[model samples]
Structures are given as structure tokens and as C-alpha cells.
Target: MSMHQAGIIEKKDFDVKPYYNQLSSRTTHLKDIFEIYYRYEISKEEKFVMTPGFLNFQDIKKGTVLANSNGADVVADHASRLFMPLYQNQGNDGFFAVRKIPKSFLLVSAFCRKHRIDKLLPLLPGISWKSKDKDVLRVNKRVARVFAKQLFHLMGYRSKTWNKEYLEVRNREAAARYNEYQNEAWFRAAFE
Candidate 1:
């Protein structure tokens, strides 16, 4: 059954449980299932990961036109119309590809490759304090979810935005200031 698209989460929302549980029949279209699930309500167990960088990030050059004209609304409206409809529907079976990889995965992987860290990569523990009983898996899973959004932000691409060489150099300078902090967190997470 086709459900109204209004109720479902957009492409950025990472919710999986709602849509996964909403299937009435095996043959229901994926989009329909997603719409019904996202339209219903947010669930406690479902995770939402819209990182600030993805939402508020942009790269505009000097002298770029922020167009001030009667046609401003028309341009903005047209862009909105085109993008809104296809934000999550632009791929087959929920997979969008920019190159060989799915757009979602590629976007996230960009950040990971940039940072030299995989955001969605599951963090496997070095040793199990409690053996295979539970402790090791628990920490590994927890670390993965917590770092997933951060890693996704680093690897994922921000559409219509450009991070030029100048900005990359500037960010590198800033990241140096956080060298100790990164060493502590990521190093420990990786080695410990």
C-alpha cells in the first residue's frame, strides 16, 4: 500500500526500526513502508543522527551572488521543489550512487576517508574482559553507534557545498590544536 510521504524521515535520519517493523506484507514497496514508519512517530529505540556539520555546513566563495532580485523566490522555490521530492527517493531500492558506491555510504565514507577513520566501521574490542559472555560486544556496539554520526559527518559529502583547499588548510591548523584530544580518544578507542 502506498503511504503519504509526509510521515517518513528524510534521507539523513538514521531510523531503522520503525520502517523495519511496519511491513504488513513482504511485497509492500520500500518507499511506502518508510513513509508509514516515519509518519507514525519517533521511537525511543530508533536513533536519529543529523550532525550539525551536515545541516549548517556550506562553502561560498567571495563575490558569490546571494542573488537579490524578484526572481530569488522563484529560484529558491524551484530548487526546493526538485530536491524535496527526491531527497530520499532518488535511488533504486533506497540506494543512490554517485560513483560505484551508494550515495549514502559514499557521503559518509568521504568523511571517514578524509579523517582517516571510518565512521560506520564497527569498533572491535582488543580483548574481552568477560570473555564472549557480553562485555566486549557491548562496548564495541556502543562505541560504533556513538561514533557513527561523527564519522559519518567526516566522511559524508555536503551537497551544494565546497570545501576548498584554503579551508582544508585552515581546518588542518585547527585540528592540530586538538591533536592531544584526538590522540586520547581515537588512539585509545583503536588500541584499547
Candidate 2:
């Protein structure tokens, strides 16, 4: 891992030996990628920089300060470093549609994972709006459980599998309401 002053995202190799011994069923880690439903500034490279002391529940917005290892404040990059300790299958048919997984995840996760992420999120109310949206969970065990998929999008989740679904607005009232949702101050605030 490179020596970051205070706020660089560092990575380390996780020993999968014990993990292989204990949990032998599903072995998914950072190697997988996802996409945000919309765009935010932090999406860079392929990973989003998670804000310090924030939970995975809310969305990231503009003007939010994110941290690196040296404690330097950077305008959050719209991407995140994913750690897939087990996946090395980066063929052309790979999901990322880019190079094989960057080493950043392995290097950065090493340093960042040391800090407990428990209290880091469930994002704060923003200057423009507050979020009251309830969890939109379904009995929907469709695929990719956990908030990682959303988080992937928030960061630099890029994949052949992820694409933005475009919507068309034409109805006057519906358009107005759609505009309301679009322009909601929360757009610059956090996600539910």
C-alpha cells in the first residue's frame, strides 16, 4: 500500500484462508460493480469515496467533503474502490467493461477497512432538504442483495450489466410532479 498522508484510500490483502474455512457458500466482495440510478460528482474511476462516519443508507450529494487516509478533505469523487478478494476472472466478457480490477481496491481497502464503518452514515439532512423516504425494499430477492449495488453506483460502479434506464415525461401534471421529484432539494441532499 502507498503511504497516503492522511486521507488516501489504501488497500490491503484480506486473508481469505479463514474466510474460506468458515463461510464456504457465497464469496462476493469488491470485484463486483454496480451503477447509480443518476449521476453525482463523486463517481470517479470506478469507485466512490465514502464519506467518513456515514452509513450506506443515504445517497451522496454535491458539496460534501470526503476524507482520505491523511485526513485531507477532497470533494468526494463519484466512485468507490471495491474489494473482491476472490475474483480474478477479468475476461473481455467481464462486467467492468474496462481493465481488470484496479489494484486500488486491494491497496486502499487495507487501510480504510481498519476503521469501523458503523456510525459513518445514514446521511445527514441537507441544507436544501430532508429525506423522509422509507426503505423501498421488496420481498425482492431479485439479485445483488445488500446496499452494495447502490453504493457501487454512487462510487465508480461501471459494468456491462448496469445501464441508466431513461424515462420520458410528457403528461402536464405528471411532468409537473416528475419535475417536483427531480428538483426536490433532496436531489442535493441525501438518499433514503
Candidate 3:
């Protein structure tokens, strides 16, 4: 089987990616691509450079000072695409580095998933489902190298390191809170 068919490829090669990238590319001066950056408060001496309502999607370099809150200098340790530069004083996320995901990726993924193509994922070596719902995925480092983080991110999965042995991926959309009472009359009446 081809590597591409086996979920081994670069972000651009992924058939199921997001559409934001495609649309943003066509528009001029539109900064829509982004990823999350959790804010870390290192010292009380540091001060923040951003303010609420500040424009987002600024490119940030590794080791560049981001803020000086509470008299301490806060610098970015890694270079990345910056999005949602935090302007608030009360949140944990400092900003998000977002990028556009092409719409075709979404379309293709939906089609494959609809046909149960994901059922084939576990058949590959070093891959398996962690939960009964089969939504949580675990993959070894070898497979992680073949399928980069962006590939799983495109598939609506958020990734986290698992015990230094595997990469654990969970679908963000599937992580939504279960509203079991949605179909109940009282729940419907409350909304109405």
C-alpha cells in the first residue's frame, strides 16, 4: 500500500484537512490561521504587553520576549505562528498560533469517516484505540513520525504526549460535553 493511503504524509498531502487555509489564501490581508498557546505565568514581576481587543495572528520568534508582567521578562521559548495574543489578565491561554486549514481537507475527511474508513486505522502497526468509544487514539513514536501532528490535527484530533512511549490523540469535536437531556421535554421547553 502507498504511504499516502496509509496515513503517512505531510500536512499538504493530507486529504482530510481544514478549509480555513484555502479561503484565507484567496483573501488579501486576512490573518485567519491560528493555533493555541497556553499562557504560563512564571513570575509575579512580569508585565503583559498585549491588551484586550488587540489584533491577533502576530508571528513570534523563539526566545523573543513576549511580556514583562510583574517586573519579570516573559519570552517565547519556541518559534511558532502566533494567534490570539492574550490581552486579558484573567485567562490561562496567552495566545494561539492559528493557520488556515483548507476546506478540501474537511470534505475529504468527512467522506472517509462517513464510510467508516477510520476503522482501518487500528489495523496499522503501533496504533490502537484507548477508549470504548474508539475516539481516543494511541500511536507509538515510529508511527508518530510517519504521521505528523498536523495530520491528526487536521482530523479534528488534539494531541498530547503519552508516557513518553506513545502519542495520545483525542477528537476535539468528540470531546464536547454530553447533553443527555437534550431530547427531554423539559430541556426543550427551557430553550423555547
Candidate 4:
């Protein structure tokens, strides 16, 4: 099935109790079934396969196991560690490389600043006023303007505008069967 179809399946609200119970009864090791499925899915040509959706702790733990077993690297902290190596590797060429700030770094910095502001709100009553009056929240104007575009690009997103007013961005990497259907006519018609 196409990644689009799989995504639709994930959005449906349905109880899996009956399916899970039946499958569990037939399997001596229930986790083995999950592992087998995970292996089959990842063995395909796709470079990446994100989980169906946001998962709870137990599901995340299980996914980590499946990923490790299938020789897939799972990054829990994508916002800091994802692209750090590229920056570190560019020794003398760092000047050119640093021109484009890593999206992960930007995201982490934004989160930290927001958190700091939140924490200081109670302790420092005039913090919000000072932040606005002094323009303390502003980063470089050029960087601020291009930050969202750069960040989205780094996260494998491509944007297109419809009707000249509505902007839409989709992550190309979100597809589990990207390689499998990339060359298909329907896939191109829909996504390309």
C-alpha cells in the first residue's frame, strides 16, 4: 500500500482489541509478531520510516527496540544532536557552514528562551514588558525572516503556495513507502 493509504489508516479511530487478542492467541511471543512486521516494513527501499503517529512511552520503547534490531538509528533528541556532527566536521570551512544555522539548534534555542521567559515571569514582574520594549526577543532580522524556511527545509519539508495566499508545507520524509511509490504515476501526480 502507499504511504498515503497507510496514513489514512492511522487516522481512523478503531479498537484493535479483537485483532490484538486473536493475534496474541496464535503467537507464543507477541512481541515477535511486532518485530517481524517492523522488519518487513523497514526492509523496503525507504530511507526512513516514522512511527504511525505520536506514541506513548511503552510504544516508544517498543519502537526503539525494533529500530535497533533492524539496524536503524533512532534519534530521541533530534533538536540538538541531529546535525551537530556536520558543524563539528567543518573545521576551517566552518565560516561558510555556520552561515546556515542548523534547524535543530534554532529549535532548541527557541525552546530554551521561551522556557526561561516562562520561568522568569513570576520572579520578574516586568520581564515581559522589558522583553518587548527592548526588543530582547528579536534575533538577527535577516535570520528571523529566513529561519522558518531554513528550519522547514532541514526537516525535509517542501512548501507550495495555493491561491497565492495559503501556504502548505509537507515533510517528504514522513512517507514510509516513499521509494516504493516515488516513480509511480499516481504518486507523482499527487505529490510532485
lDDT of each: 0.29, 0.31, 0.63, 0.35
For all predictions, the C-alpha RMSD in Å is 18.8, 21.3, 13.4, 18.3
Q: Which prediction has more favorable lDDT, 2 or 3?
A: 3
Instruction: List runs of model 2 lying over 4 Å from the truth.
Output: 1-98, 126-192
Candidate 1 error regions (>4 Å): 1-116, 119-140, 156-192
Tens digits of per-residue lDDT, candidate 2, 55-75, equal 322334554554332344545
lDDT score, candidate 4, position 136: 23
lDDT of 4 by residue, 1-192 (tens): 234344433424655567766756765432321111111223343344333333211233222322221346643421111111212222321111012344566565455443443333224322221242222222233433444554434334453333332334443444347687677666565543
Of the candidates shown, which would achieve the greatest lDDT relative to the real structure? 3
What does the lDDT come to for candidate 2?
0.31
Report residue 158 deviation for candidate 1 (angstroms).
14
lDDT of candidate 1?
0.29
lDDT of 4 at 149: 51
Which 10 consecutive positions of candidate 1 have the poorest summed lDDT?
77-86
Deviation (Å) of 28 in candidate 4: 51
- Could you estimate the TM-score for every candidate? 0.17, 0.17, 0.56, 0.18
Once fitted onto the true fold, the runs of candidate 3 whose alpha carbons sit more than 4 angstroms away are 1-28, 31-33, 37-54, 59-64, 76-82, 102-116, 177-192
